[model samples]
Target: MRLNKTQYVALHLLMIFTFPSYPPYLIVAYYKPELVACSIPSAFQGQAQIKWSKAMITVNVLTIIPYALTALIIRSRKTSSFSRRLFRSLLLVMIFDVGSWLAAVSFIKLL
Candidate 1:
């Protein structure tokens, strides 16, 4: 699959947005439940909490939108080479997402 420049950028952006801090968040939630839970209600917990949550939601949503769009683009039986490459790239992103999540879970469990 030969991804065009736009598709390559899109896929890289999706991967960046999806997985960067996800594992750390998962680990924190697992190991520091009280702190994570309290931060949600503690308005004065400072700007970091607010910023992190906002970024997390925005990036996750952005990642999902592209993947869904790619799926639809592929399912429509579009025959463009670029679309095919985009579809394959999106599939790899999906796989990487799952693998990252699993690795996070395993690491948390091992601790």
Candidate 2:
């Protein structure tokens, strides 16, 4: 499938926001849950909490790079059909980012 200029731009922007928009919530929720007026579940307190927070940060940061790359590739392209490799990369970015966003939001709600 080919994306027109508008779709390319919009998707790129959305991917770019994927990291900036959501990960900070996870980070904040990790460090100062009280500031967000939400507490981690009692079950997750102590060492478990710390471990979970570290893992969350690691995964979120890892996903950010690819999404940023996908966004950059999309932004630089001037054609109707981007390379198949880029399309695959973008698809993976969307899948991972969307999944991570959903999970983060749900976890934050628990906070």
Identify the runs in model 1 with alpha carbons over 4 angstroms from their true place: 1-47, 80-86, 94-111
Q: Candidate 1 at 85: error in angstroms?
A: 6.1
lDDT string for model 2 (1-111, tens) is 999999999998997788455544544554534433354433344454556566656776776687678667676875356565667776786678767665865776575
Clashes of each: 0, 0
Which candidate comes out best when scored by lDDT? Answer: 2
lDDT tens readout by residue for model 1, 1-111: 999999999998997787766545644553432443332323223444455546655665566777778688677976788878877887787768856754653554355
**What are the RMSDs of all candidates, in order?**
10.5, 12.0
Give me candidate 2's TM-score against the actual structure: 0.36
What TM-score do all the candidates reach, one by one?
0.36, 0.36
Model 2, position 6: C-alpha lDDT score: 100
